[model samples]
Each structure stands twice: as structure tokens, then as C-alpha cells.
Target chain A: MSQMRLSFLLPLVAFGILALVGGMALYGTLSGSRDPTQLPSVFVDKPAPQTNLPRLVQTGSTTGNNVSVTMFQGKPVLVNFFASWCAPCRAEAPALEMLSKRVAILGIAYKDRSEDTTAFLQQYGNPFQAIGMDADGRTGIEWGVYGVPETYLLDSNGVVKLRHAGPLTRGVLETTIFPALEALGS
Target chain B: MMIATGLWRTHILIGLVLLNMAIGLVFISATTTPAYAITAEEMLANPVLEERARNLSKQLRCLVCQNQSIDDSDADLARDLRREVRSQIAAGTSDGAIIDQLRAKYGDYVLLNPPLDQATLFLWLSPLGFILLGGLIVMMARRQRGAAIATELDAAERARIEKMLASRDSENRPKT
Candidate 1:
């Protein structure tokens, strides 16, 4: 009788073990997967980090004064991390140029030499109001930058409205970036 | 002479295996230098703070690498974060404050251990809760079955059991 009674538990225990293993596997996959659309940037909706950086010397301009992130406020600004070596940065250049006409844009040239950056700007028309040199990528770290060609939009209040990890295409600009900017009101 | 030859053969086989293992260990050790990222030049001057830095680093995630702690990562960002931690320690920042600053900057995802808050409460507790619920269901099923056996047996069923035992007893009786 006890044996028969215990037999009922066989499937139940087996199912329990299966459920446990499956649940853990699913949880691990879901948590570890960096699905780009669902990527959690810690900076979104948080205040932008303030860091002091030296201005990149523009070929045609004489302004050598350093720029600080805190100084650029009261209007929405897009902070772009780019390097001369990053291929995507070149690909996204025109899109940034297009956006710059309608919105304020700043560039942080991460880990690039001065001549290389100047040459990159010459090749791809300059779109930034001020270019900060993040030669050591220290300031990039402060801003939670992981890679080049990442764009962050800060609302007028200096709060981060959006972070796009890859190179920007016009389609993404129109669909996602524009909507967020519109909602944030410049 | 034959036994000595066999013994030498055994020793040569064992020697080859040990030699392979030693070479494997040497290669592994050569590649693992980056895992211990701290160089003498980079370590904090104070031994106490240096110890804390190592412990703190193990609790932080390497953003670029999947499932690796900053301590175990050789990525550039991981190195930057390590430098940041060491600099903070040198500047006399409290460990909790530094962790909080990083959490604020990078979010809870950067921490190796997720926080047990209201939203994540389920994440931390669900597996155990599920197992316990499963156990409870099985126990309840077992108890219900046990009760059915004692109280729900039909009269014919009871009589059948009596007859079976009676036959067993008769079979055991002494044969003439």
C-alpha cells in the first residue's frame, strides 16, 4: 500500500526537478541576454555626469579653452563618443550632422590622437559645437561609456533622456530619438 | 628480469602522464597573469585599503564581459573601473559610498550581487518557494492517499483481503 502510494510521487518529483532546472535555465538566459532593445543603461532618466575635459583643437578655429559638461545646460544636447578608429563612427557621421542642425550636439573623441581626430573631422564634416578630448577614456568611464559611437541625449534639465549604443541610422533617429526628444521638449 | 622490465614500463607511462600535466599547468599559469590584474605599481599603498579594493572589485561586474567579475576581466573598461576604485580608496572614500556612487552611475546591473528589493524579491526567493510548494503538493497528495486506504475500502474488498490471508494461513498448516 505504501509502495503504491509512493508511486504517485515519482512523476511529481521528476516534474519538480525538471521545472526547477528549466526555470533556472530560463532565468539565466533572460537575465544574461543583452537584447539591444531591452538593454538597461544606468544613465537613462538619470542626471548626466559632469566632467571637465580639454577642448579638441579644431583646425580652423582658435578656441582652446576647456569645456565642461555642466556648462552646457538649459537646452537638450546630444553627447557622442567617437574615435577616428571606429568604423561605425564614420558611418554615423552624416546622421549626427543631420541631427545637429535641429539639436545641439557635443562630441567626446575617445582615445584618439589629436591629428587623427582633426583628420576624421576634416573627412567627415564636423557637427559638434565643442569637442572634448577623452584621450585616456577617463571621462568616458565617468559617463558610463562602454564603446565608441554611443550617443546620449540629455534633456534641458541635464537628465539623460536616451542612450543609443550603436551607430545611428536616420530610421532610428526618426522613430526613437525624435520621439524621446519631442517628449522631453528639446 | 621480466618483473623489472614491467615495473620500468609502468614508471615510463606514469612519467609521461606527469610530464604532460606539468606542461599543461605551466601554460595555464602563463595565461592567467591578466586574471590577477593588480601589479605592484597599481596596488594601494595601504595594505588595509588594498585588501578592501580586491574584495570590492570581486563584487563588481565587468560590463563588457558576460558573467565575469571586474577582478577576473582583462578588458579596458574593467581596468578603468579598477583604477577608479583604487583612486577612490586613495582619496579616502568610504567603501559603501563608492559602491553607491557606482550603482548610481552604472545601475544595479554592475553589481555582481543584485539587490534584494521589492521588485527583485521574487527573483531571489522564487526557486526555493517553488520547490517548497511542490513538496507541499506531494505531501498533501500522499496524506490524502493514505487516508483513502484506511477509510474508503469497500466491504467486498475487505472480505477479499481476509480470504487471501486465510488461504495463506491454511497453506502454512502442517501437512498429513
Candidate 2:
């Protein structure tokens, strides 16, 4: 009787063991690196998306004029995508402002209210020549923005020279962007 | 006695159902979140540095996501972690040093393949131990079964004895 019970339970025990080990192995495999490196490149040597945006603040007490893509022509423009809520944007702000002296920069306020964005620039010290409000994030999608604080370096011909997906650190601005811009000759 | 047996069966059935539900919940909790996301900024930083960071990121699992590394996940926390790695690498921090820092903060759970240490020794050894233990138990059970069969007559043996008695009774009756 005991032998019969043992025989019946052995397969169940084996299955239980198999399940435990398989579960652990499956967990390891499933949780392992799904790194984004293998995905197709989104913005490598592509032309900057053309956009005409209204200025964030009217400097001359006049109606806010639309800043067109032509304004960035004949110069390297650093198009920065940022929001007031993004912490990395705050960290990268000073470095961005420093880079502004050497290159023309335009800000794209992604998914932020105009009032909040105005307050953010006031606190962080705005480095951009013309800030474009992308209130609904549609413009950000058009620009292939995966997240905030993405900076794109555009050449004189409006072709994207490089796309930096995070904050603009001093090292990146100096080592990568500056040299690349120098190669393009302003 | 019959009522007691019925109550016991019901209690066991309920217990089994609850146990299965708990197991399902643990499995779901352990396996849901993504690992990490290595962004373009980190990739384009520097070839040598980026390679090191990428390798380390793959080795370290995200604490919140538990099962995933910071490299494979698209979670906001994962993105923040990738940014932290980029800043650290750009600042010239060594890969080993960065891992140590993360391990100190998050415990061994952060490591996808944790080192064979006192804390994680059980995790590595448990599976093999269970397999060996199970094999031993099975062998012992088989031995017990064989011993029981050798010592005890089965129902067939009892039926054979009854047949012998019946045949003897017929012979005695005929002789009379």
C-alpha cells in the first residue's frame, strides 16, 4: 500500500522540483538585460525636423513672432527638449547655457504649461534664443524624443550632426559637440 | 466519526486552494517588471567607457523591478539609473567601483549574477541540494517498498491460501 502511494507521489514530486528550478531559471532569463542598444538607430546624421514655433516671451513688447527653421540655417543650432518637471534638465541647464555662447540654441518645452515653463526658465536662467512651447508633446514625438533633455546638434544645412539623449554635461559639450561643430565650421 | 471525516476533507481542500493562490501571487510579483534601458547618450559618450558601463549595467538588476537589469527596462527608475551611470562614467569612475557602490546601497539583489558570498550561498546551493535530497528520498522510499513487499503477503497470496482450503474441504467430503 505504501509502495503504491510512493509510486503515485514520485511523479508529482519530480514535477514539483522541475517547476521550482524552471521558475527560477525563467525568472532569471526574463529579468535579464533587454538593453536598447540593439534597436535601430533613430537619429544618426538625419536632417532636423522642420518646425515653426511661436516665441515663449516677446522681448520687444510686441506679439510673439513665429521662429521658423530658416533662422537656424547657416549656423549650428542646438535644439534642446526639456520640461520643468525633469530633474536631469535642471542638472544640465548650466552646462547648456555655457555651450550657448559658442552655438545657437533653441528650447522645446515638452508637455509643460507656459506659466510653469516661464517660471522654470526664470529660476534656471534661460540659455535659449527662442523657446518653443510643445504643450501637448506632439512636436516632441515629431522630433523622436524618447525623454526629456535631449539635445540635437544641427549643421548649417539643417542636418542633425549628433543626438545626445540625456543632459549636456561639460565633458560632452567640450569633447563631442564642440569638435563635431568645429568640423562643420559654424 | 463520519462528520469529523467530512469536515477534515473540507478543511484540507480549502487549505490546498489557498496554498495554490499564494504560490501564483509570488510568481506574478517576482516576474512582471522590465530590467533596464541603455540610452543613446551613454552609447555615444566614449567607446571604451560605454562598453564597461554596458557590461556592468547588464550584470546589475534593478531593485524596484527585481528581475530586470537597468539596461533592458524602459521604466523611469531605470532611465534615472542609466543617467547616473553616464554621469559616473563621464566623471571617470571605474566599473568595479560603481558596482561596489550599487551593491552597498541595494544589497546583493542588484547583482544579476551575485558573487558566491555568505549571503548568497544559499541561493546558488539550494537547487542542487533539493535535487540531491529528492533523489535520496526516492531511493529510501524504493528500499522501504521492496522490504515491505518481501515481508508482507499481498491479496493474491491470501486468495491462493483460500483456494487450497476449499480444495481440501472437497476432498474430505468426498471421502466421507
Candidate 3:
């Protein structure tokens, strides 16, 4: 009789455990601690992709400076992929400007024309130390960038330590960026 | 009876309508082609390479538009990916190598059909586990029901059943 009672309770116990797990997941989603759209970064703990993209050049200049990963070696830096066409990139401009004061930031203008990017920088207040032109988005792919306004933090050794997808709002800076920077000891 | 028949006819008509709608949906989906996002500029000159590129594009998920395959998505990233695949195929890169490269850059999420791995083990096994659990429960229920029937049978009733079975078996036996 006791065994039968226990058998009857087995499904209930299993359901309780499943419910608890599901509830925690839902709570995490609701609390902004988890983003349903966020994918696990394969670049984390890996060496950052080396890029040699053209610098956002002057209008009249036939030749321009090239932006490369080696230029920022031996110092922790942030690589931000942004495009003039992307609204979130504009939204995060001020936050990127604030972050630039703390850490060196190399921006890659993804799939945007040079003139538009220059105009955008002028309007939004250029915070990037050096901006690379990813006009074809090849560099974006090499960096595993799905969309613009993606930020990655690299350690002094040029290893990617963290990746944050989406706009860097003040709230994200406080909760995600600041802690990640602290963890990196930067 | 006429009213009852009319109601039954209405039910059958509704069922037929539902069945027709389901078949119509299947037919429409089968007949319609997805709007191809591959532009002329991205297409390879070699027909073979272009064919391979197209096949490869269908396998890759558009990271921007998570639901659509790169072949079917007009998103800029998907267009870039299509171009990349075509260029790589033209350059003599094997399809497997190209897929592996993308998988390495993006996680398995980039593939529409996720591969079986440690992360997806439970996802792959849950159906089998549920089936086995259900089978176990059904078996246990049957055993418990059999025990209940045996317990309900008194010694006299059991003897009577046994006697009845013996006579029935003997009656069915072939004459020698």
C-alpha cells in the first residue's frame, strides 16, 4: 500500500521539479537577467579575429590609414561593430562615448558607406579611437557579428573576454559592462 | 429522426470543410516557392558552383532573421552570407569545410538542424525517455489490476474458474 502510494506520487514529484525549473527560467527571462535572443558567444576566451580594414577616411584623401588588431595589442580594448543605418548603434553612441573614457574602443562601421559613417560620427559625437570600415561586412563575419551594435571586450593579450549583443544602455553598462570590466581587471 | 439526420449531416459537412482546408494549405505550401534572396551579383558564373552555393545557403540559418534560411531571407547579413558561400565555393572550398567554418564562428545555432551533442543530449533523448516511462507506468498499472482481480477472487471462486477452464480445454481438444 505504501509502495502504491509512493508510485502515485512519483509523477507529482517529477512535475514539481519540472515546474520549478520552468518557473526559474521564466523568472530569469522576465527579470532582464536573461535575454531570449542572446546566443552563447563562441569568441569568448578565444583570440580576437585579426582585421585590416580601411579607416573611415577623409572625403578628399585618396589614401587612408588601415585599422588592425595589432595596433591595439598590449592594452585592453573594446571592439564595437556599428553601422550608420542601425538605430541601436545611434542609441548606444553616448554610452560608447562614456565607455571610451575608461577603455580604448575600436569601432568597425559595418556595411556602411564612408560618407554616411563620417556624417553619423559628426552628428553622434565620435567616441571611437579609430573606426574601421567594414563596407562588405566580411570583417563582421570574421568577428562572428550577427548584427550591428555588438560589443566585445578583449584583454591586453588580444583575447576576447566578453561579448555583449545589442545597445549599451546605461543600465547595461552598470549591470553587464562594469562588472565585466572589473572582472577583466581593466 | 429527420432533425437528428440533419444535425449529423451538418457535423459531416464541417468535418469535410476542415479536411479540405488542411489539404488546401498543404497544396498551397507545396506549390509556392520561397522568394529567393540571392541576387544576380552574388551568383557564381559556374552553374555547378552556384548550385552548391544555393544548397549550402539553404542549410545556413540567417542569424539576423532567426527563422529564415539565408537563401530565403532578404536581410543584408543573409545576402552577405550568400555571397560569401558563393565566393568560397568558386574558390574550391568543399561544402563541409565551409559549414564547419561557419559552425566554428557561430555556434550550432546557425544550423537549422542542430547536431546531436552534449548540449542537445537531453533534447534528443527526452522523447525516448518519456516513452519508456509511459511503458513502465502502463506495465505497473496492468500488474496492479491483475493483482486486484486475483485478490477479489475467493478460494471457492478460484477453484470454480480452474474447473471451468479444465472442462473448456477438454471440450475443445480434438477426438483421438
Among the numbered candidates, top DockQ falls to 3
lDDT of each: 0.85, 0.75, 0.88
Top-scoring candidate (lDDT): 3
Q: In candidate 2, what are the lDDT values of residues A1-186, reduced to their tens digit?
A: 777787799889889989999888777657642323212224457777778776687342213677665788988888899999999999998998888888889898887877888888889989999888876665664565657888888888888788776777776677678898788775
lDDT of 1 by residue, A1-186 (tens): 665656777778889999999888788767744343334678888888886787877763325588777777888889999999999999999999988987888898998887899999999999999888888888887877777788999888888989987789886788779998888766
On the 0 to 100 scale, the lDDT of residue A15 in model 1 is 99
Each model's TM-score, in the order given? Answer: 0.74, 0.44, 0.82
> By DockQ, is 1 or 2 better?
1
Q: Write down the C-alpha DockQ for each prediction.
A: 0.43, 0.07, 0.44
Ranking by DockQ: 3, 1, 2
In model 2 chain B, which range of ten residues has the least summed lDDT?
B35-44
Over B1-176, each residue of candidate 2 has an lDDT whose tens digit, in order, gives 99999999999999999999999999998998753356565474578887777777788776446678888777655665666666678888888887775554344556788799897899889999989988998798879978876987779999999999999988889553
lDDT of 1: 0.85
lDDT of 3 by residue, B18-132 (tens): 9999999999999998766777877888898888998999999999889999999999889888888877887889999999989888879889988899999999999999999
Q: Candidate 1 falls in which docking quality class? A: acceptable
Instruction: Evaluate candidate 3 and give its CAPRI docking class based on DockQ.
Output: acceptable
Give the lDDT of residue B109 in candidate 3.
Answer: 83
Off by over 4 Å in 1: A1-39, A60-64, A184-186, B1-34, B144-153, B158-176
Candidate 2: regions farther than 4 A off = A1-41, A58-64, B1-176
